[model samples]
Target chain A: MNKQLVNIKNVTIGYQSKKVLDSVNMQVNKTDFIGVIGPNGGGKTTLIKSILGLIPIWEGSIDVNIRKSKIGYLPQFNPFDKAFPISVEEVILSGLSGKKHLFKRVNKTDKEHTEVLMKQAGIIHLRSKAIGQLSGGQIQRTLLCRALISKPELLILDEPSTFVDSQFEGELFEWLAELNKQIAIIMVSHDIGTISSHVKTIACVNGHLHYHKSNKITAEQLAHYECPIQIITHGEVPHQVLATHKH
Target chain B: MDFFKGIFEYTFINHALIASLFSSVICGILGSYIVSKRMVFISGGITHASFGGIGMAFYLGLPPFVGAAVFAVLSAFGIEWISKKGNVRNDSSIGILWSLGMAIGIIFIYITPGFTPNLMSYLFGSILTVSTGELVFMGILALVIALFFILFYHPILFVSFDENFAKAQKAPVRLINYSLMLLIALGIVINIRVAGIILVMSMLTLPQNTANLFSNNFKQIILYSILISFAGTMAGLAGSFWLGIPSGASIIFTLTLIFFMGKVLKILIERLKRKQKQFLPVK
Candidate 1:
């Protein structure tokens, strides 16, 4: 039996006037690679937001044992005006936001470590250059480095593979696979096929939680989602299976 | 040399020169924050709209600077209140408030009594007439802006990049936002004194855009802005002395030339990089 990491029980999440998620229950263990998949506006992002303490839960309780330093997050909506006057290195260094002291100067050791993380994320070459000059893949990788700066134990990636070319998606998944050994991952993705191999479990969310074990994602579950699942399966004709659910 | 010696005969010219440098420095520093916040448009709205305060000050026989600062600060808060529509959708509301504030300012000026001749300078800039007291006040405000940037550097950076994430980090996000508005208010006040309300946005925007050429970090942004502003100020002062131009207009023109130079430099650098990449072997 593995240690439970996150406990969510009967939680209802909504804004001041509207309820988006109702009575959700989920439990994540140390070794569980959970994928929270759901349709758009089915409270997928809202659930993730609640975990990040971004939204108020109208009812129930969500107890996350991890500290901010221990839980890394890759935000879905990267609204940074690309033309912002900042460097790639500076932006990546912001990942250390979780662990940094407000009044203290970022010391030599912090810089050295940030450089190491940038190298690990494979963006060391673009370090000194402006962030605006980087490609979409490079920016995503940079944000990942920022998330990894804390060396977190639990990683929450909100559609990390979105907006990138398919050719590099495999490589990005491979990199994520390597990181999965050291940390539990809860990826909220619509690319079901890509993430199926990397994650250990799937939490099919449509304002609720459906937990599953194993990497094999069934076409039925994919169809059942009514929106999108965050896994890739090894079974069936891939394109036909996807095309069947397109409607 | 003989032609130059003739210009310094008037004490006001010397005062104008000193005042120009002081005003440029203040605007350069505060404007860096504004541009980085992407709030120049908002600040411009504040500056033009702040004229209502000046008219009110004229009506009450008080210093226009005091009224302008008060009204601009109040308006800044109003803008923030209006921005509560999820931060992303409140842009239209901000746009409406911005124009309405300016309209109110213009109306106040129209209704105010007496033939105020130099109000045009306040509408634009009258660098020559800026007094010693105003210069000192600008210095103090500049110092405050600099101090705020230094002391709250991390929180400010965090909020600017990702406000929601910053809030989740349990950072003083609200305080940071309020502080940002306070800084902007100070910026509007200082800008009015230096460039007058009319050309204040020029002082707020031009130097910062030019500075973005070389700066990557926050401190570098401040340094580059000051340097760029100083260069523009010097050129404008020289132009005013030699070409018999209004110091304010000359400053704005010099700043524009500096921004143009920055664009050229950026283009040249990109071309050079492309050339290097083309000539190199692919891995």
Candidate 2:
């Protein structure tokens, strides 16, 4: 059965007075791997924020079928202060935080779970290292482990490849593919060529949403959907497929 | 030996020692959070804003600490509320409160009809003059803060590190933020007696920065900061006694000296380890 995880209906959201997303409609199923692509300031991040309930919607509803806690989120790679004194293990374990666990200490089971997630994420060796000591890829991996520690039913990653190396990007996609067997995934990225090959469907968001059923999308399709993004194909001879400009 | 003997002989010295101990514990824990969360500016604003309360209290013939506490808490909450609204720039709002509070304080003090209130104690601190009531309050505050940190350690860490992630996990982010802000305001006001308003920010940040050089672990930094704070306080007390200097100024000077020393030592240790590593044979 295709279990519906989230349904966004006529969703309108934005910063005050400036609408970023309007009448945005999208449905995420249990096994759906959605790649959200849009130009900069094109409301892709706003759509996700609305879906995550981080911002208030001006009009419409976003229904999350699963428990809100079961939706793990990996926010965009912010340039965090390198001097922040926190260990990788501590950062990962923070994922287990909830109303129930607020006053309680992290027990042996939680530690064991963190260890297992770190091992799976290949960050077990760096558990004791502070986040400042880790490379960008290592930090991304640590955050990935944190996003997974809750055993979430749906994972939301915002430009996970932004600060990572190519090697880690490949590994991240592979890991995401493996995780998608059991859970749904919604990834926002500007790299159309890369994400198109990995995602099961595509959502072109530019003030609104155009949900494409198939991962394969043409430049014409992107232009038709009003998503202005360059498509850089990877091959022996790298080429760029620029969307048709109306102006 | 003389200092140790003086602690047993002089009641003022006894009060100073107890005040140092309690203030260290309170500042050490809150300082770690302040440094990690990068809320030093907000803390400074709250500290300065409390001066308004002091001035108002002086004018109204109320205890300065009471006025300071009320003003500090109100400004802290105001800053928190304003920042949440996202209407004004965070730093600009802080600047407004910081200067506004100071201006209000000066105005109140100037208008007061009594003999000129001695502002030195409030501005630069007089640790030796700490009262028994203040000591009791500090003791209770230390206990409460310790209990709060112990019980909500993980949640606090989670929220401090990444507020959005904590919120997504259904953590009480708002409650924790407001509670910590209240605690921070109270901590700043109480410690004003130990380190005057001008030097209190250093007390909250210097030791934590020194500890950060040695260990990047949050808990370790807190522990190290507490120890370092006490040592600096003691050393500063001794220096103040010998040099006939102000206790608060001496304490801040010692802490700054310690921070520089720690930085140099960290550099030396790293160089030594690098040199040693170069001599090792390849595996």
- List candidate 2 stretches off by more than 4 Å: A232-247
Candidate 1, CAPRI quality class derived from DockQ: acceptable
Tens digits of per-residue lDDT, candidate 2, A61-141, equal 999888777888888855457677878999988888867777678999889999998887788999899898998788988
Model 1 lDDT per residue over B62-111, tens place: 88888888888887777776776345445665576567766766676677
TM-scores of the models, in the order given:
0.87, 0.94
- Judged by DockQ cut-offs, the docking class of candidate 2 is medium
In Å, candidate 2's interface RMSD is: 1.5
Candidate 1 lDDT tens digits, A62-148: 898877657778899788777666677777666655535567666788789888977776788889887778888888888888777
**CA lDDT of each prediction against the hidden true structure:** 0.75, 0.89
Off by over 4 Å in 1: A1-4, A15-19, A163-182, A225-233, A236-247, B1-11, B85-91, B106-113, B213-219, B261-283
Native interface contact recovery, all models: 0.38, 0.78
DockQ metric for all predictions: 0.38, 0.65
lDDT of 1 at A164: 69
Residue B270 lDDT in candidate 2: 98
